[model samples]
Target: MDEAAGSPAVSRRIAPQRASLRPWLLLMPLLVFLAAFFLVPLAQVAMMSVTEPEFGFGHYASIATDGFYLRVLADTFATALLVATCCLVLGFPLAYAMAAASPNMAAAMMIVVTMSFWTSFLVRTYAWMVLLGRSGPIAALLDWIGLPHGELLFTRFSSTIAMTHILLPYMVVSLYAVLRKIEPSLLRSAASLGASPTSVLRHVVLPLAAPGVVNGLTLVFVLCLGFYVTPILLGSPREQMVAGVIGQQIEEFLNFGEASALAVVLLASTLIVLGLYHRRFGLDKLWG
Candidate 1:
């Protein structure tokens, strides 16, 4: 009997090793692709950032000493934070409605959101330009309503609005996925236990939905940091993002070293934020 028991224990120990090997085998192609495409190019960019023009940290030094570069970095973080907050404020209720809707209604809402995604990003940005320009329908409507004539395009407000529009769908989808798993009976139970609707939401629902909120905010913020097209088409020179700065360095200035340096900074900042989010909120909960 001891021998039989020990045999099962040994098998259990070996089973995990076999299972691990299977996943690694399955992931081999992805691993090879990441090494070839992502790792190799990243290493090349890092090398270029440091050694492109006379080496010895000049590219990094420019980022530290130049006020213009520092302002660009600040603006990038500011815009990302603003957009993420806006998405959260606007998306949470929408997600709740979708999650609570009938299957048919939810499916219709999903189709509309998916269609928005399928439209070309460039076309979307340009469309906003046409809608918000001085001679556009929105501008004309405001004038007809006796409002002061305003220039909406090529401003920070337009940039924020366009980014919020583009990113709101992502936020809604993330929240909806998590909200769906929350049992409706839980809310009913809370209400039956003398909890007000507001109290149930404040104490139970918010805590349960936090993981999704964090995930969505992190995703939208990171995407906002890298935004280029909307800002380029609808924003002023002062509203230029880090991506715009990098583009100018490459295209107009022809300064590969500076461009590589900016790209590295952007990459490092994104990874740092992701690391902090993971540390604060065990990323396992995202899947859980």
Candidate 2:
């Protein structure tokens, strides 16, 4: 029998000083795990980015000078911004509807959103492939309607639409959380004070939902920055994003050093976004 267990009441009354150490003690294993797996691997990648194929920052220099790499990096950010904007535009109304619905209606909407989200990511991408392909239903419908079905597959438009669909639930849930927390009386009071519905939403609701907007944008943008399969499969070969370029370097050219460097750049960009958010609003508040 352990002494701590034998004298349960005595253990519960342990000195206050030791209680402070308990949290750290409980966290030790997770710290060790992250240090071993995450920190060690990151360090290795950083070392390889500079040291592989002879040292001396050649990969970094090339990235700075090369037009192709610079263009891809720019395109990556542009696409992420587009995707995040589309998500917010489409999600805000749906989330508002969900919040405004009765309990049963809201519950059903949530279930549908959750089911879509839980469906395999690849499955969603492939479904988009089927829908956007030349012989698919969308093109068929266009043709039937006497409209010219110009090329749709392997276009930026297709990729953006698919990515938006895949990420929409994230924005919806973020907005739904914030919207649900808003007091109904506040909106009623605004109306009673002779404010129009649009005015009430613009002044009161939008102000309250700002945190969720920031959170959804940050979440979607960061996720879009790292998007791999969707862009490669759906986007044009001429327009490549950072993740696709990184994969091409590793798989097609076997340029590990350059790929590692690109990966580091992407990681740094993500960290900068997070840092800006933290500076604006504490990280703890973002999740809430």
Candidate 3:
């Protein structure tokens, strides 16, 4: 009886083997659902990429050698990078303001960010369409200022701006989360020690916020890589993104093998970004 009494304490200190099993048990249904609906379909598409055109890798070869496809792929990656940078630049200040604000003010700012984030994707896209249109406020202002008008829409500028706006909230939220964790006393201490605001930001705040910065960049870049609607609706024909090219292949050319190959390439690019992000910052850091 004495030994059994101690056994309960021992068992409490030693985590059970079933502890790991419980999480897997909980995840089992989600894994099964994903396997059925997502993985299986994805596997079918990947299989078709090589199999549909008589078991040759001709589709991939075309993508590798073709100038137009290469250009679109290059543009897609460059645009993603640009948009990610824009989001960071725009969100960092906003996030810092949120972190530095009074509680009520921060809450209000967060509500605004949340609202922007939850706004319908199509609505935002169309709003840009209206804002950049020939009869829109932007064009009207340009005309009033006696500058060139009607050159705003259907350009890379419009598409890039729209994508940056759409993704800015992700960066702001990431930065806000990390910044909020930083004890206010730290900043106050730095200031008390005669550290200038810029110096404090450069030395202390930035280092602490590095993880959030990386996460934000990763999210925005990966999301932008597959972005289609804004580019298609607002970008010029010459500015076709990889996704737009994939759509063109399917809709206009009726080429499934090439489209699947393009899709596989897009997936590979996304995975590569995520892999780099994981290497630089442990994947667990993002979720945790």
Candidate 4:
């Protein structure tokens, strides 16, 4: 009996280690890919940021000392925040509706959202440009409505609208995944306990959905921060974002140092936000 008990305990001890090893084994390929593609590239960029154009911290110093660069950084963060907030506000209702939908309806919605992902992003941006440009259909409609002719294209407003549309699906899908997992009985229980519809939502639904909301917000915010093509196509010079600035430095000025420095700053900012989120809300909760 003693030998049998000891054998069980020994197996228990070995079981967890063996199980852990399996996951690490499964993760080995992903780790190798990340190290090869992401870490190596990132290391190269960091080296270029500090060591190019005669070395030292000149590129970073320019970012700090130049008022125009500082303004662009601020604008980039502002635009990202605005786009995230808009996505949240717009996506929440759609997510709720999707979650409450029947299986067939939800499947249909998923198909539509997935189809959007297959569409070319550049084509979508150009479509927006064609619709919003002066003398385009929207501009013509405004003129016919007795409104003043508006130059909406190539403006910050146009950029924001386009980005919000592009990112809305991400937010919806994130929230939908979490919302679908919630037990319908929980809401029914709240109602049975004399909770009103608004009370049930305010107390039960919102708390349950908090994790998904945070996940979606983080996703949208990070994506918006790194936006390049849409902003370049839709925004004017004054509305240039960090990504646009980085691209110009790399492509037009051939200043890889400054471009990499800007990229590092953007990367650091994103990491800080993610770290704070993980600290405050435990990363495990984000996966539904």
Write one digit per residue (lDDT tens) for candidate 1, span 207-273: 8888889989998998899998889888888868999999999999889999999999999999888
Task: List model 4 lDDT by residue over 145-184, tens digit each.
Answer: 9898557998888999999989988889889988898899
lDDT of 3 by residue, 74-140 (tens): 9999999999999999999999999999999999999998797788999999999999998999899
Cα misplacement distance, residue 269 of candidate 3 (Å)? 0.8
**Where is model 1 poorest over a 10-residue stretch in terms of lDDT?**
279-288
lDDT of 2 by residue, 171-276 (tens): 8999999999999999999999999999999999999999999999998999899999999999888889999999999999999899999999999999999899
Lowest summed lDDT across 10 adjacent residues in model 4 is found at 279-288
Taking all chains together, each candidate's TM-score versus the true structure is: 0.88, 0.91, 0.90, 0.86
| lDDT, residue 127, model 4 | 90
Give the best candidate by lDDT. Answer: 2
Query: Model 2: residues >4 Å from true position, as ranges?
Result: 1-14
Backbone clash tally (model 3): 0
> In every candidate, how many clashes are there?
0, 0, 0, 0
Residue 41 of candidate 3: its Cα lDDT?
91
